[model samples]
Target: MTNPLPIPPVTLGAINMEAEDPQALAAFWAEVTGGTPAVSGDHVYMPAAHDGGFAMFFQPMTGPRPDRAASHLDLTVPWGSRVATVDRLLDRGATHLWDVLEEYEHVQWTTLADPEGNAFCVAEHPPVAGH
Candidate 1:
């Protein structure tokens, strides 16, 4: 019998977000992540700053922001920089929700909302005991 054709890998290309001001939102993300932001047609995009990561795209959106519990971005930093990172993000127009380290007592992440009220988490995950 003939072998079936090999299946190709599926990868994520970009994460699309809706913002009141796509350009400004894109710029904010670019500044924070050190990614380059560019506009094309009706959307603003920031290519991923790391290899194997997907880009970020912002589209024009109006009206009240939706409930973000359904989906949110989780940003990982160094092993002990969660507090400092949360402070920096706060200084850059992010509103702190709560520090999970204190609230949950089992997590090393902080939750915050961007200037436009999009929820995201800044986390510090320790390296596993064995690779």
Candidate 2:
């Protein structure tokens, strides 16, 4: 029994974000990601909508929000529709930051900020072989 077995792969279960208004911010993210938000004590939790979807937890912060975030989220869309998604997000109260694109490249992405000024990216992915 000298050899040890490797640990199983772990899936990302949830991400914690700080907000001035936890419940409101959680609701906003839940709407954006189609998750379900529930209030629990001082934090708001958003359960995943699908098998691969990760939960989101919003916690209330005492002072003002940070000027910069340590990390941001990246959302993906079907290939050739990244711009459309950016447009749609813009119409949904997102602020367009910039576009990362180049000719002949199959994948492209755009950066945006949520209403609370949190940065996120929307990327386009190539279609699978069959569909």
Candidate 3:
């Protein structure tokens, strides 16, 4: 019997920034993350390095949310370890958005936001065995 081919590595091409002003927002993130501008149908796309381990995109929002949780980003971290990485992120200016360190009894994730009030999280990746 022939063995099956291995799956390819996943690449994050882009993510939505949900910016109130996309041009300015892209410029800000570009300065922060060394990103560049990508072009798409009258919209300015912000390009992120594929190997940086996370991807980001920008879109102009007509208005802002009245409350939180209505807006957030879902980010994935490597399996079984988040401490060192999360600390590294904090050092880079990502602030704590919310903490579930106690209420949930299990801190599934520690939510965070960037300088522009966009929220994302740090969480453990579910185990993947026999890959």
Per-prediction TM-score to the true structure, in the order listed:
0.81, 0.82, 0.53
Best by TM-score: 2
Q: lDDT of all predictions, in order shown?
A: 0.81, 0.82, 0.63
Task: Provide the global lDDT of candidate 1 against the true structure.
Answer: 0.81
How well is each residue in 26-126 modelled by candidate 2, as lDDT tens digits? Answer: 87677578898989898888989888888998887767777788899988877877777677778777888988887436667888888788999988867
Per-residue C-alpha lDDT of model 3 across residues 78-112, encoded as one tens digit per residue: 65456665676677667876655445533457787
lDDT per residue (tens digit) for residues 1-131 in model 1: 77699879888788888888898888778766778999997789899888865699999885676664588888888887888878877787889987777554335898888878888888887766674
Better of 2 and 3 by lDDT: 2
Native-to-model Cα distance after best TM-score fit, residue 24 in candidate 1, in Å: 1.0
Task: Report per-prediction Cα RMSD to one decimal.
Answer: 3.4, 2.9, 7.0
Q: List the residue pairs that clash in candidate 1.
A: none
